[model samples]
Target: MAFEPRQTSVGGNIRQAGERLFAIVEGALEEEREQLALWVPVAMGMGIVAWFLLPNRLEWLGFCCFSLAMAAGGMLLPAGGRVRQAIVLGGILACVGCVLVWGKAMAWGTPPLPRAAFMEVTGEVRSVSAIPAQQMSRMLVRPIDAPALPRQIRVNIAQKDVPEGLGEGAIVRFRARLMPPAPPSLPGGYDFARRAYFQGIGATGRALKPVKVLRPSTSAPPLRARLFAHITGRVEGPGAGIAAALATGDQGAIAEEDAEAMRRSGLAHLLSISGLHVTALIGAVIFLLMRVMALSRRAALDWPLMLIAAAGGALAGIGYTLLTGAEVPTVRSCVAALLVLGGLALGRDAITLRLVAAGAVVVLIFWPEALVGPSFQMSFAAVIALVALSEHPRFRAFAAARDEHWLRRVGRSLGAMLLTGFAVELVLAPIALLHFHKAGMLGAFANLLAIPLTTFVVMPLEAMALLLDIGGLGAPFWWLTARSLDLLLVIAHGVSASPWAVMMTPTLPTGVFAAAILGGLWCLLWRSWWRWAGLIPIAAGVAVMSMASPPDILVTSDGRHVAVRASTGGMALLRAGAGDYVRDMMAESAGFDGEMSALADLPEARCSDDLCAVRLDVNGRAWRLLLTRSDMLIDKAALQDDCASADIVVSDRRLPPWCRPRWLKADRRLLWRTGGLAIDLNQGRISGTKIASDAHPWIVPAVRNRKARSGNQL
Candidate 1:
């Protein structure tokens, strides 16, 4: 009888625990039910990421089949369970996203230039953009005579080489030296060739002679071009560039120094047309239209004045997007604004995660490739962070509270803006580090003053100046605009000059970046206390990034330039006279902002007329590297002796088979196959942009050309 009572008691306890667990799960699901849809885009984005990470294009077919199977399996599961349903939906959406990107890639992929050549080119001018800072102009041409070339070719023409009155739709002829789109200068660096492929630019080159316009453009210049000219003409000095950038979304005119200041200060977003500009303009339009319509009490009372104003605002936003050349960021913002305006017209709250999700879906559906770009990633991350902040209970209460003294209200608004800036900076830091190898530390503080000044003072004044230009009464407005821009510039330069303004990081591993992104998304997307758990991954990523070491040596794809880590913790260039672009790229990749030293100037390097030899102490081991400085051939016996003694050898010319290095032989042939190379002496590791075994569509052309050359030589 006593044993029976004990057994019954234990059973009762077990039953109670089971019931509690079920209730907890049910409650959690109930809390998150409304937010479930927000994860659909994330699922889709995962599939897109998968597509990019595949080694072979044919793998996409297998991936697609796998995704379909997952979706089908999920659909076959029971439907009444919320957890099951959520899983199934996410799986289906992910499959859809994978299929969508594959389709887009197949459809949009363009053939690259087969080989480098010098030829006379005749084509219709599709577009022209001026780079005042460089004193040059670039044109996109659709070749008529060169059927072998891509449908569109981009040419950079010197100011002296450009014909007078060159504009879009003109037929032009020029002699140029053209080459296939350049690959990333170093591993993990920017891939201009990939972007070019998607953009349909088969060739990029410099014009060797003056361009002759056989037929002048009959159509009027585009509004964007006209506005650019007007703004640059009306406003004098560097501020004119900033004004034009704000108005027309063309930032080519901005001075390099000023642009650098903005980037370092984290105010570069101001120069780009994004959510801030679009919102300010559309909000002003709606406010003005609403007031005008409300002037007639009948419209306000009976005709739905708010809806009418929203409609007008929508039209203005679309027109503005088109006028600004409809760049990706601008289009994204316009779409989001249209959604917000739609919500207002329908009398619904729209500034929720759902809104951001919808915008992401639209962009991903059309420009799936953009998901891999920094702009799409950073912009969307910032928005999600901001929206999540707004959704916080404390923040919501504070924002909703309006009955306060005028001074208090103003103070509260300023505080809110600063807080928002801080949140955005926090979320965007990892992305910046991953893409640019640096992130602005004091960006939030810089943004505090810059945002309000640009949004309220500069944009409004610039708009007025542009509107009044038709009457030639815009001088005063233009002057005001310039002065405001000058102040904004002052802020950027001052902030950028601070010692602690930016944090530089070495190349971040893909896994670390992914972890950081997931952590941030977890924290931002979830409303429960479990969201704080995301901090674990965030901190882990940052910790890993901080401890990561940079590569000791970097070799360019063409094997013409090499950089070695110097004792002073900066990079030393094999070629002392390397151009600014090469120096900057190497410096950024090394996470070093200091001036690069010449290899000959370094204490550990010995240079001759033909070669530079470096001895490095890496991880307590002495490593010797021999780098060729000239194309002159060395005596085979001397080359073999030197190569046998060295730990690594890099040469612009192909090394003889007898000249074998102990570790690596990075010669012209090897570099041609690997693209760019980064060597880490500490870890005894080497990374390249392309693997010899992989055959991606973008890489096939280069491989084929190389094979053809080898065949001819044979």
Candidate 2:
């Protein structure tokens, strides 16, 4: 009898604990019921990412079919509990997203130029972008008779070579040297070829001679062009480019030095047409419209002035978006603004994660490729973090509190701005590191002054100047706008000059990036105490990234340039005369901002006419690298002996089968297969921008030229 009573007591205690755990989970689910829809876009974005990561279009097609089947099956599932329903819905949305991006890639992907060529090009100009800093202009052209070329090609023409009145819709003929869109200079670097493919740009080239205009444009110039010209003409000096970039989305005119300063100081977002500019414009319009409409007492008393003002703001936002070429960031902002306006008209609060999610879905539906871009990731991340911060109970209570003194209110406003900036920076740091390998350390402080100045003084003055220019009364506003821009540039340069301005990092692994992003989203998306648990993954990602090491050797796709890590923890270039573009790319990839030394000057390197031999200490072992310096034939015996002894070999010429390196043979043949390479001796790994086996529309597989057998036989 005693043993039976003890067993019953233990069973009763276990049953009570299980019931409590179930109740807790059920409560959490109920609390999050209304927020379930917010994850739909996130699931879709995951699918889009998967599509991009897949190796080939055939696999993408197969995945699309699989996704569709899953979605269909999800629809047929029985009415389960909320957890099952949520899982099924998320799976369905993810499938839809995968299918959507696959379809877009099929419809929009363009074939890249197979090889470089010099040809007489006759085409109609579809669009033109000026690069006054370089004294050049680029045009998007549709070929007249070249059936072998892509539908559109971007050609750069010198200022002196550009024909007169060669605007959009003009027929022109010119002799040009064209080349395939360049691939990433280093592994994990920017993929210019992929970007160009999606943009319908197959080739890029520079004109050899002056362009001749066969026919002039019949229609008037685009409004965006007109506005750009007007702003550049009105404002003198570097400020003109800044003003133009702010008004329109064309950033080509900005001086390179000035743009770099802006980027380093974290003020570059001001140059882009994004949420800040759109919100300022819409808010100003609504404020002015309400004031004007409410001035009529009868209208204010009886009319829906708020609704009318909201409509006016929406129209202004839409017009601004179109005027700025409807770039992705501008379009995203416009969509979000329109949603907010709709909420205002309906008397509901709408500046929430749900609103952001809706805007993301709309953009993804049309431009799924944007999911991979830095702009979309950073913009959405900042917004999500800010919204989540604002929704916090403590933040809401503080914001809603009434201040007794005007100074206290001002302090409160500033505090709020500071908090919001910190949150944005926190969330966007990983993304910036992933894309650019650097994040602005002082961006929060810089934005405190830059955001207000651009929002209140520069943009408003520019808008007024453009508006008043219709009556020839814009001189004063134009001057004020220019002065404001000058101040903004000053701030940018001053902040960027600080030694602690930026935090540079080595290329982040994709898994680390994913962990950070997921953790941030978890922290931002959830409304319960468990959301704080996301910090564990975020911390873990940071820890891993801090311990990660950069590659020891970097090689270009063509094997023309090589950068090796020196004992001083800096990069040394095989060719000292390599252009700034190549040097900077190598430096960035190596996460070394200091000056690069010449390999010949290093004590561990010896250079001859045809080859440069280097010795690097990696993982406590001396690694020998034989890099070709010239195309001249090397002594066969000496080359084979060197290759046999070397750990890695790089050359533009194909090596013989007997001349094999123990670790890697990154010669012409291998480089042709794996675009650009990063070799990590510490990890015994090699990463390429384009994998040897990767098959994609934008990637042209390399094939050996049967006739080119002169060098290999030696």
Candidate 3:
């Protein structure tokens, strides 16, 4: 059908165009945005750090391709020389990266597949998780499990008394977990397991059981290592564990409950060495350094104090990130600090949205994986929102009305907390459902409760406590920091008690997610007043969430367990002692409330002294089936009316010699039937292979192999 052009209101059309323009401008602001806009580079820088951390060769090749394209484009860009130089420099770095990866690949046949198991690993108390530094003394053990041992085992020891001077390189012996490190899921998702594989850690353990420290093990280091460790020990006192964690990010003391609280509240980022922490630290350090430099002539003008401080902060940020497991978040912070410093060195006006954005793009080109991580997504979402808001008339009005009064400051904090909490939650909610199958509603509130305490109270106290430790005064600060940490924990507990704290759920369709984002862009980017687009995600969230239809019938690791949710909403679950993964998936995909209702006990349908058998009258058909941990068999109880009625049997046992119409897994929700009867699976989809435990799900959708459809998209 030929579509006719309908006249639309000028205002409405303008709004649409304006939003597209806003998305473009906000994205372009990477070149520069007043104040916080330069965060794009920060995001990008972190991505580069992630790129360097991986042991993959394909990604290196991809990184090279992206760098070359970006470098070529930079020359033609109307941006500043510095921007162009960074791009070119990135390309040069890419070449070096290619060489390095090439060497590693050549040496190891491939980048290095993850290890199956590490034998008899023997190591020491290299690092520990802390509560708040200068507080209660505790350390986590990443026990050594070497490759020579037939099996990996984890050994934990919590010491009651320790020499105050015992430091790093404290040797110990033990077994580690024999985990077959989980492989990568998506192209660019974080791979801590793989990273651990390279780090020689086979298992993680807590210092639960007390182990006698034979003596302080001895080890020497390069000048840099010793200096860094000395500084680390001085700042992160032996006692103030959480303080050390704040500085170094070893979260051993962040009890599981505390960690869960932070995660649920969405305030976990505050404790980590993410951008917020680094920015605050950089600002503090620059102010301190400039003041100090003002006192000396050579240091003042000769060193370009701001530039020097930025550089110094960058180094310190990177160092801190390394201590905090050198994970993705820290890497991003370090990248941001360096980019900000680079801006200072060039005498650029200020870090702009466009510049940082360009940096982020560059980073993504090199490490596409960052695009999928929650940290990267949330950090960028917040940055972009803030940048867009900065350019809006309403924000300017609000800022003019209330600059910095105490009440205004509190209001601003409240406002920022509200905005950040909601923005991050909303942005990542869809993906959160896909991953953990839960939506923490009060996460923002949790963060609000925790962040201030962390920034103003915990971090500061921890830093001070670290200094005290190297000196003899660590014990005094430990008490105060511990108390502060406790208060933070208390706040988390209070907030988490709320009924809306979390919602366990399933993922939304991709189409809906896209619509929500587009709708959000309307409110976030193009703004004069709130409009229709802004309401998309909210309305979609409510409508679609309310209308979601979950499947029934769950199968477990053992074929013996079968959970079926009938059409009447009645659930029948076979008593399977271990069905954690199956139960979790169901709980995640089906609403927690639904799961609560859908759970039912299953008494054995049949037991036999001779041939083990179970019988079920399903969909008006009499079928006798053999149920074993391995497989199953199906037959018509009577040969006459039900011969064509009974569907093919599913089992770990070999396929029947008869019809091969289809097979399915017990876990799958899909249902099938023979001839005229559509055997309603009261549950859901089940594939032939799934039930048989012989093939992959993808093979079904791809029923026709490549040979049959060589030229087809299929």
Candidate 3 lDDT over 1-714, as tens digits, reads 245544586777998998787556545444333333333343344334434443244665677677678778768744554455556656655554445434432333212223334344445555432223224343333345533421222333334433433345665543333433333221112244334333343433333323345446465533333433443444322323344456655554444556666666655665656777777677667767778888998787677777777777776766666655656666655676677778787887444456446545654544444554566655666566655555566655655445477987778757865775676677666656544556678877777777778878776776666577786687666567777777766776776667777775433454565456556655654333344556867588657756755444343322334444443554444444535544544444444433433223333234332122334555664434333333334343432222223333333233333422233322111211110111224333332212111121111222223213432311
Name the weakest run of 10 consecutive residues (lDDT summed) in model 3: 669-678
C-alpha lDDT values of all predictions: 0.86, 0.86, 0.49
Tens-digit lDDT track for model 2 on 85-129?
665677777778888887776798888777888899899999987
- RMSD (Å) per prediction: 3.8, 4.0, 10.5
Evaluate residue 9 in candidate 3 and report its C-alpha lDDT on the 0 to 100 scale: 62
Query: Tens digit of lDDT per residue, candidate 1, span 1-714?
Result: 655656458778998898787567667766887877888889999888877777666776677777777767767644676656766776777778878887876788776787888999999999998887788888999999677888888999997778876788899999998888887878778878778877888889998776889998887888888889889998877898999999888998899899999999999998888999999999999999988888888887899888888999999999999999877788889989999999888889888889999999999999888898998998899999999999999987776767889999988887888889899999999999988988999999999999989988998998888788889899999999888999999999999999898888777788999999999998898888777989999999989988989989999888888999987787899999999999878877778777888999999999999988899998789999999989887888888889999999998888888988998999988877777788888898888877544544555475755744654332
Number of clashes in every candidate structure?
0, 0, 61
Error of 2 at 258 (Å): 1.3
Q: How far is candidate 3 from the true structure (C-alpha RMSD, Å)?
A: 10.5
